[model samples]
Target: MSVDLPVSSPTWVSAFLDLAAEELERGSAFWAQVTGTTLSAVRGAQHEFTTLVPTDGDDHLRIQRRDAGGSRVHLDLHVPDQAAAAAYAVELGAEVVRPEEREDGFVVLVSPGGLSFCFVGQRATTRSRPTSWPAGHRSRVDQVSIDAPGRLLAAELAFWRDLTGWRLRRTAYPEFHQLEVPSSQPLQVLLQRLDDDATEVSVHLDLTTDDVGAELERHVALGARVLASHDHWTVLADPGGLRYCVAGDPPDHDVPA
Candidate 1:
């Protein structure tokens, strides 16, 4: 039976930067500075969630603090009906983490490949623009890179492709696949295959800048330390202990074949 996928694909909403409470303030502050966004009033019973609001666009970034756990980044998907989306996700191999639906229509589920994300009931239509710094560079933290171990990458890639209703394209690198989402969407996902099959699936944010070298310096000045440098991207550890990257990839929206 051919399954209809168009009307069911969820919208990419926000990326959650999950850090320890102690590091939450520091991390959220640092992220706010780098992304050129302001912190929204913290919400949640424990005062654990905050939004990174931009001056001209709908929010696509958020922060979450955990009572105890290592820092990590998670994705959020917005759908017209979150409950229906959650059920569809389960039918597509996602396991429910928060089985009882919340009043807000937020549903948490772990993808078959082990990546955890939420299905949100609301929507974000205004995409954020890249910020221009006084020092002479423009950048936008507009992508979430999903790192899946070699053996699981294929399945994970397919899952994300169908879930986002994005055009899946093969990149120049055999290890990477691009989910070509609508350019109007605030964020996109890049599926990267890791070398070790035993390595767990994880995610990180990617900020694209016109001047990678300058952006690298700016990040370091903001307390991010370099982990490694590639020809087009630099991996770094954020002040909150989360890992992300700064890349010189042009915002041309093309995934090289």
Candidate 2:
């Protein structure tokens, strides 16, 4: 089916950040990304998952969607200083969404486009060893992907291409294009054709599911719509209309040993 998407680049634009991944703490990372919290799990999987509680008005973390793509694919970077990082991000044309604040020795920040990332005030005391994947183990975050209006594809591509100097990675599917950038994590930015111009922002937290069909049924019970799918993945919109995906394909990164 034909979909509407962007085909031109924005005339005036600035630089974007190239994010990198470090196996710091997945639960910490997950909590950071999902709820904007900087705490690690008290007792749980440390490498592949993280959790947090809500206080004040922060209860929105669990149910609320993080992005339109369902999972965040932008780089999770570690920086030496939050203030310096904020300064550099501004210099690079990223408007501040969250200012640097100390919490567990790291300051978390989300980019202008709602990409969640962190800046560290101190270095990690220890580094994680790499892991190789078996047939179906939870692996490192391969890449976070997004879907954009097809009419905005050219504009979006121009913005990112100039920023990263990376070329577009095409798939057999005609609805989207992917861009790979430099980062320890296998990240891809997806430009997808949208049916409505009313749809603006794209962000969602992705969860791995063994069966997209079954997951979609579960989500339908919870309240969401199946948006799109392919041989490897299926997209769904949460009750709030935020989009995300459950995949049948193996992840791009290997599992840590």
Candidate 3:
């Protein structure tokens, strides 16, 4: 099942954190400081929506207050033609949770693995300058990692490949794969097969940093708890108890094996 996707059209992907209403303020504050961005005035009839305004580029992060479940992160794909984009995603096995019609419409979809994402009409033109870390810290959220049950790995990988058209490559680690987006895109998507029997798919954000130690320290001061430390990456939980990682750059698509 294929829908015509214009080769010339650009797609912009952004990330959003959805937290319980009770944790919205704390979660919003924590993410704002971590990303060096400010929170916009809360909008939406329920006052559950806010955007993280970066100092330079377009805001790629947002905060939403949900009624249930633990905090989780999801992606937003911005394209010029909302209808076509959403139609193609449905054809790729996504279930449409909400449909859209107007130019500024929003279509919510859940992937085969049950992970949620949205397609928004029109590209975000405001490009912020690359993130500027504090005096000693050099890091930015350059990729999002999706953890899927081992049993569903193949189907999950195929769903994302069809949706984004990003080139997929195997990593040095057998359990992990990288969906390499074009250099023009701001974020990469990593798919990791879980060893446990868990059947649900979930996502976590990752930051690439030059100095993991220094960056970890900064995060600790900002109320992030260190869960574990490894040579390549450090596991951390924010004030809202959402887990994320800070790591050195991993191999890229152009890198030789």
Candidate 4:
């Protein structure tokens, strides 16, 4: 099987914020404002998809209206020969969830740990940059943390690392294995080993912000709630009830100010 994925690695990754129909309006607006983006015209078979168009670079975020789910995050890997990438992913233990979607060049898949993502052509070359806000604070939706059960962590890690061919590295947190994507790539990847409690895989996003305090306050004023706080990061639920984090100073800035 000759599956030719992008030769330079996938440059664009669009994280899809799947929200319940009732939350679409509020969620779309909230995400756009928070990320310094404008919502693109609605497009999809059922008018269920909208891209968050950024001001400085290619798009890397999208919102999807779902009929029933509360709120969830899935991503689309934009690679050349999407069909071949889907096939390659299947060979690496991913299960195709929507073969029918391939007619239009979209194919959904579930990872070994059961987290859902799909494939699309790698059309965007420029990466989405961090947004500048009041007080000159900069933040970008940078990473997606895949939370997996202890029993499945090993396989999950193997599947993602192998599938993306990214450098697998250890993180400060013992439970985390970060996949170091090239700076050209839109989103970073983190595999978190969870306590052997949950039976299913799940995902949440992280926005690397230079000023966490300001970001938190701004987000709260825009209809977000703090779930928990740590020295390095703060977790919150957005207006549409989707959870994410305002992760402290990005990884690139290793030294303290």
Candidate 5:
């Protein structure tokens, strides 16, 4: 099936950290400290949703309490028209997992490779701001890296490209490709080709820190443990066992001094 892509429209990309219902309080507290944001009142029929209201910019981050599924991160693409965006995603090879309508007009869809994201009507305003660490810290969740099996990289890349109309660029690393969203957007997404036979798609958040060591220590104090350390980035598992990374400056943002 062929679906024509729509002209790039005003879009806002936000990240949601999903955790088991039991872990919502713990997760919310941890994330609030990590990002220097305060938690808003819990919403949703089951009181399963909350936003980490930032001090400035739009609130581009949220936390959800899920009854099933392991803890992980997902993206919410807010566009002018939710229905049109959802249709465009279906044309690009996504399946609607939940067709239920929300008063806010958002639909949940999964990518060709199984990564779950949503399309929602554009928000009236966002309080998103660049990563500004607390007085002694210089780190924030600024990027999301989507890991796809080698076999699905091409389709996944094309899907995201046509969906966001973001500038696509290759990195020095052969397996890494970037969908560079506008600087005005809060978070950037990177598509990574995994060197494995696995076909499922998963995502991890990336923190851009001026001092990896300091940030690592801070996160460890906040309940994250180091899984691995690399020259440019360090992998750490949150209290709930979700793996994320702490790296140097983001390509699209200025490094804090």
Candidate 6:
């Protein structure tokens, strides 16, 4: 497939990139205060950064576990036409998924190399603009840092790189191997390995809800285990034991390994 980025992107792409950068910086600063560790960007990966913060402070976890790859590392593009978007994805060799219905609008999708993304409609007047990320006023946030199970970081990364044509954003270290998306937004998918199935090996989902506690309670009613809870969010392990979370804010926790 001949992958082509649009000659012109929505005005919001630039805006969103700026916002994403800001939020990353802000997140770094916030984490720094909490951990007393310095923040730094990984070399050679534009917009890819990390912090060396302490794990057990500020009621926050002692070690901050973060990487930019996982099932949730998706983007929501607002194209003028959903069908056109799907067709474009097909042109890019992405496998199209059904355009599902949501309360706000419809989601048309295509997963490039099994990485999923949605094309949502501009249904409401007050919709989230991608540029709001840097201002820390984002509407939709997507960053996935997965915990892969084996010594397959290099192989997995090479597969994705061959599949998506996205360049490597960072090298493999004790923790993660990072990939870059064209835009500045939080389009990270992490590959992590867990011990003794501490968390289930499944694609986990994270949602920003009105009330973390209330939503946690609701999921509990539906039979989800409360794995971990903090002031910012509540972690829920699904019946299948996959770990996910709902919170008032984005995931900025640092869990030391």
Give the winner by TM-score. 1
| Alpha carbon lDDT of each predicted model | 0.82, 0.41, 0.79, 0.83, 0.80, 0.41
Off by over 4 Å in 4: 1-9, 100-103, 250-257
The RMSD (Cα, Å) of candidate 1 is 3.3
Backbone clashes in model 3, listed as residue pairs: 56-128, 57-127, 57-128, 58-128
Predicted structure 3, TM vs. truth: 0.89
With candidate 2 superimposed using the best TM-score fit, by how many Å does residue 16's alpha carbon deviate from the native?
A: 19
Candidate 5 deviant stretches above 4 angstroms:
1-10, 100-102, 122-127, 130-135, 250-257
Global local distance difference test of model 1: 0.82
Please provide, for model 2 over 6-49, each residue's C-alpha lDDT reduced to its tens digit, 9 standing for 90 to 100: 22111111111111223223323433432223443443222332
TM-score rank order = 1, 4, 5, 3, 2, 6
lDDT for 183 (candidate 2): 35
Model 3 lDDT per residue over 72-140, tens place? 998888887667877777777888898885643888888898999888864665445435565654567
Model 1 ranges off by over 4 Å: 1-8, 100-102, 197-199, 251-257
State every prediction's TM-score relative to the real structure.
Answer: 0.92, 0.47, 0.89, 0.91, 0.90, 0.35
**How many clashes show up per model?**
0, 25, 4, 0, 6, 34
Structure candidate 4, residue pairs in collision: none
Model 2 ranges off by over 4 Å: 1-76, 81-88, 101-142, 150-155, 158-168, 181-183, 186-188, 206-232, 238-241, 252-257
Model 1, total clashes: 0
* Residue 142, candidate 2: alpha-carbon lDDT: 29
C-alpha root-mean-square deviation, each candidate = 3.3, 12.0, 4.1, 3.7, 3.7, 16.0
How far does residue 160 in candidate 1 sit from its true spot (Å)? 1.3
Q: After superposition, how far is residue 83 of candidate 1 from its true place, in Å?
A: 0.9
**Candidate 4, 130-242: lDDT as tens digits:** 78886878888888999999999999988888788777999898989999886776778888998879887988989888788888889999999999998788999998788
Residue 52 of model 6, lDDT score: 38
Which ten residues in a row are the worst by lDDT in model 6?
10-19
